[model samples]
Target: MQPILANELCKDLGSFSDNPQITGVITDSREAAPGTLFVCIKGERVDGHDFALAALQKGAAGILCQHDVEGVPQEKRILVKDPLDAMIQMGANYREHFSPLLLGVTGSVGKTTTKEFCYAVCSAFGSTLKTEGNQNNEIGVPKTLFRLDSTIRYGVVEMGMQALGEIEKLTLAVRPAGGIITWVGQSHLESLGTRENILKAKMEICDGMPDGAPLVINADNDLLSVAKVPQRLRRVTFAVHTDADVRAVGIQGDEKGTHFTICDKEFGSFPAFIPAMGEHNVADALSAYALATRLGLDPERAAQALANYSTTGHRQNVVQHCGVTVIEDCYNASPDSMKAALRTLADYPVCGRRIAVLGDMFELGEISQQAHESVGVMAAQAGVDWLLTVGEAAQDISRRASQLGVNAVHCSDKAEVLARLLSQVKAGDALLVKASHGMALETILEGFYKQFQNTTGVQDKIAGECKSWKNSRF
Candidate 1:
């Protein structure tokens, strides 16, 4: 980050007496260095106010805190009502120095993939920076905005929220030139009550953009399909099953990648491919394509750039182990994403059978039971040869799937899940492991790699190939 005066950093947020030129912004006191401004944050477990003196002693140029520290002088501190809000203000202040063409992305699912797709598309036109991983909340947005500089011509920020008004604050601060709402699902139904509420919250990305700024959307989403947008903003649509301004056709996927044709009115049609599968991923790429084209980028360049898109951590990452296809999509899950993953699993080319290990989908509130059961029905509908479910909630999946004639097992824990799989899993079987981030289902794969080494003495050769799957890769 470019250095700014301590008073300048305070600009509209608070007051600062000293004029120390702050070189960088930091939250942790341990990272405090000369010319750096330490922003005190009062978290649930640790309070940054208690460490203000330590930061100052460590050569921090200034402090932005909610309360005054005993030893820190007034000249070196910027006082405010809340440090988190102040941090947002600091980010907005810092962002005032650059003029990058910023775009904001938010949704119940596919936000990260769409953001990465946008990154690939935008960077083809110029240098770009995007929110790394799932950093798309209050704290994450400011941190992402802080990365802006003169050299960056495109900036993609992913915004995530659990309730209403959260995305509003983020979009106001981001002030994106354009926005993308990938799809609205029941991800935060526990907090927001319904998909309608989720849609309301997701549309807040347009709260800060000026009139006519394009807001790209997935027209295939049932909730977003009928929902209304602000009349002043241009709604750009993309989908596979619905009539949209931008769409994907001739969609097909296999082990190597997915290939499709992008159909846009202004750009005509062009073949596009991503080194990943899933029609959902194709929808994500379409959204990125729509966003880039509406933001004055070349449509052909955006389509070509879509080929460079890759999956982020633990998001439907496919691996081949022991001559079996394994899909590790154990990041975060919702009923919608679970269904998508199951469809992808069903589509995998396998000689023997298709097996699925589905865990719990969190934050469904009163609909949790029905949601889990529906996933079980989806498993059966996907023609899964066997369904193994972990977690207490996933028992519903097993129960419902079993009622539908699918060979299903309900494991009490990961231990039981691994044992049951080890006895039956063999070459030519395709396996899918999916759950919410809290389930830590990745450990099940680790257990498989360990048990494989014990049962077979070819552990060395397997280790050379799987690398123990120690790093969540096989």
Candidate 2:
């Protein structure tokens, strides 16, 4: 973000402050440096207000806090009712200084990947900035918007929500020129109550969108496929199986990557290869393709850029560890994502058993048990050789898989899960480790990388060293 005087932030956010020039903005005190504006947010475990003085000690230009911070000069602090809101307002103001074509992406799944894909595709057209890591919530989106500047010709922001109105609040802050809804799935079902409500929340991405702005959606998703688009919005469709405005045909996937034909009515058809293993990822590519086409970018160029698109860390990362091929997708899990990963594991060729180390999928509300069971059914149908389940809720997956005549085992914890997996996996076995982010299933992947080292000790290409979002959000 461009350096702004404290007076400007105070005037924009309606807070009290002197004219201190701020060069950067941050929330965590540890990340604070000289000329930084530290925002104090009250999270579940800790309060940022407690560390306001630490940030000041670290050369923060100012602190945005709800309370008066002691030890810091009064002129250096912007006092407000809510630090988060104040930061959001400042971010909105920061965004007004530039005119990058904004693309806001949100969905239960693939939003982050789709955002990255859009960034890659649009980078060919112009300079692009995308949401860093998993900063897709109200706090993260505004921080992402703060990154807008003259050099950036495009901004691809990912918007995530836990309930109704969250996406609305984010979209209003972004005021995107275009939007992409990757797909509506059973994520946050515990909070939103049902898939319909999730769809309703996801649709709020268009709330702050300008009238007649292009909105791209996944046509293959049952919830998004049939949703009626408002007349004020120009709707663009993308799908793999279903007929749509932009569709993928002649699709093919192997251990190397996925190769497919991207067919658009206006752009005709072009073949694209995404260095990822899942069909769902192919769907993500289609979502990005739709938005790029709407933005007047060349379809062929966008397709080529997709070939350069690398998979985000721990999200279907195909790697060879300990002489075994591991599909380490233990980032976040929902019923939809779990099924997709399982299907990818099934389609993935393996010289040995196709093993799936599954874990609990959180936030399903009353359907948590049913969701786990459904995943087990999917695992059985996918013909997985083994299903090693972790966590209390994931035991249901083991029970259901056993009932379906698949070899299933329920482990007590991550160590047990690892032990059972290592005992069964062979040299050519393809193992998929996946679960909700809360479960910390990545530990299993870490263990595989650490304990089961190959002669080279590190295959950087497949080792997944560039893991992001290591810190989980509640």
Candidate 3:
């Protein structure tokens, strides 16, 4: 981060200080260093004020705190009623000073991957900074803003929410120049209740957008396909299965990646490839391509850069383990993303059966069973041969698949599921492992890697190759 006067940080507190220059901002006190500004956060488990003195001892230049701590220089101390809000206000103040072209992204399923595609495409034009990992919440957005400087030309901020008004707060912090709404789905059904409410919440990304800012949306989603946008906001639609301003046509995929033709009304048509499979990923690429092109990036060059796009870990990572093809997509799951993974699994050409080992889909509230069963029906329709599941909610999936005459098993124990999979899985089969994040399905992937180490040396390769791309900083 560029150095800023300590007085500028305390501007929200109606105070000014000329004694210090803060070169960096951090939330954790342990990360404090010389020329660093520490913002004390009161988390559920730990309060950061207790560590403020520790941070000062580590050479912090200043501290933003709700309460005073002993041993801090009086000249650098800035008091605020709410430190989080003060941080957001400071970040917004900093953002307005630089005026970088910011692109805000919000969605149910593909926000991270879509943001990654935006990073890869926009980097072709100039320096770009994107939200790291799942840092799309109130705290995360401020951290992302803190990283912005004069060298950055483009900023991609991912916004996530579990209820209404959360995205509004984040957008107000970002005040983006452009926005993208990847397809809305029933991700947070527990709190938000329905897809309609989810759509309403996701649209809040534009609540803080500037006038005349282009708002890109997925035209293929059933909800977004008919949703209305504010008249003052420019809406750009991207689709793969419907007529829209931008589209991906002639889509083809394999275990390697997806190849498609990008059709834009203004840019004509061009071939593109993303180094990731699944049609859902194609939609993500289209949204990024549309945003990058609108920002004056060469359409062909932007499309070319997408070929190097890599998905973050556990989201459809294909690997060869123990001579078996494993699509380790167990990062997180929703009904929409589960169906997309099933389709990708079905599409992969395999000499043996296409097996799907699914776990529970969390946060569905009253519709959890129906949502899991819906994925079961989708798996059957997608031609899944063997369906193995864990968790009580996934029992519905196994039952539905069994009723559909597909080979299905609902295991009650992780050990039993592992033993069954180890006994039956062979070299030629293609397997997909997915579930909600709380299920910790990655443990199963690790167990598979350990159990297969005696048969093949592919475990080391999978670990080395499948590191999450979330750490990539543009």
Candidate 4:
């Protein structure tokens, strides 16, 4: 962000301060540049206040500090109750200078994919600036807002949260002109405790929306239907199952790609194609199509742009390992997403065996066991040939698979899983690796990739050191 005087920022935020013009805002002392304003944030591991002298020595023009520091000059410091709050105020201040249509997106799943789709569609309409690389949290959101400058005609921001009020802070910072709630699901249920609470937290994105701004919603989510969205705000609904303003029908996919039909209120039904899997993704495409249409992009052009949309890494991305097809969705998981992945697996034509390498879902709180077991039952019912589970909580999934007479293996660690999978998987098998981001299932995926390369005589094209056990030559 451009350097602004401390006095100017205080005026924009409506906060009282003696000195206003204090250069740039920075969170890390190491990144503090000359004539910049350093914000000393107390985070989980590091305390920024302790680095005040370091930042000043690095040429920070001013500091936003939570506590008084002895070495820093009093005139160059702006004391606030909370540094995070101060950062939020700065974002609000920065936002006043830009006149762009702010599009905000949130949901239990598909937020990132939907955000990408929105960026693609909006880019076709005007100059766009979007969230780069999962910068959707407390720190990331404010940082993203600061990146918005005068040239950006439209701003698409992805807002994520684990608890209540987080989205409210972000929405207030950007004051989005439009919003999209992808779908309500069982993610972050550990902290949120219940689906109802999750809905409330996601709906907080609308708390700071303008009175007449468009708030797009998924009519399929029962909780969202009952959300206390403001009466003054304009509401737009999209769905795949029920009749809505935007809908996807006749969806079809294979190992190669997916094809579907998009029906809109004004444009009628149009064929839309995406190089991705899962019906949920088709729904996400519909949301993007609707938003783009509302923003004045031609329906045909928006659908064409969506057809070019491809899945990002680790989110249902398909890879060929030797002769086997591997679906590497190891980025993250929840009960809803797990079920969706299994359904996709079920739809694929498997010549030999269909295997799922599952891991703990995490953050389900007291219901973790039940949630895992529920996914186990889903895998069994979906006709998975074998179920391999990792972590202590995932034992419930393995047990449920066994109870349903499905071949299930429970491993305490990656080594045990590799040993078992190496013995069972053959050339014609299709395997899916999925778990919460915390489980680090990508390590297990890398192991399988190495095995495939060795057995099938396929060299690793991606150059990097193998971080785990060496490839076991059979």
Candidate with maximal lDDT:
1
Better of 2 and 3 by TM-score: 2
lDDT of each: 0.86, 0.83, 0.84, 0.80
What is candidate 1's lDDT per residue for 1-474, written digit by digit as tens? 777787777788666655778788888999999999898988889999999999999999888888878999988887888777777777788888888999999999998888999999998899998998898977888888888877899999999998798888888888999999998888999999978889999998889888999988888989888778899999888999988999998886644678888999877998998887788888989999999999899888889999988788878888777756788899999998998999888777666689998899899999999999999999999999999999989999999999999999898899998998888876667789999999999999888766742243232233224322121110
The most accurate candidate by TM-score is 2
lDDT order, best first, reads 1, 3, 2, 4
Name the regions of candidate 2 deviating beyond 4 angstroms. Answer: 15-17, 72-74, 453-474
lDDT of 2 at 196: 97
- Looking at model 3, the pairs that clash are none
lDDT of 4 by residue, 44-65 (tens): 8999989998998988877878
Residue-wise lDDT of candidate 3 within 1-474, one digit each (tens)?
A: 788777775565755355477788888988999999888889999999899999989988888888778777667678888886787777776676687788899999999989999999888878999998888776788889989988899999998987898888888889988899998888898999889999999999888987778889999999998889888888899998899999998886543577889999989999998888778889999999998788677989999999868777787788877657789988889999999999888767665689999999998899998999998899899899998999989999999988998899999967777888888886667889999988988888888888854254344344334333332211
Provide C-alpha RMSD values for all models, in order: 4.5, 5.5, 5.1, 5.9
| Backbone clash count for every predicted candidate, in the order shown | 0, 0, 0, 10
TM-score each candidate. 0.92, 0.93, 0.90, 0.90
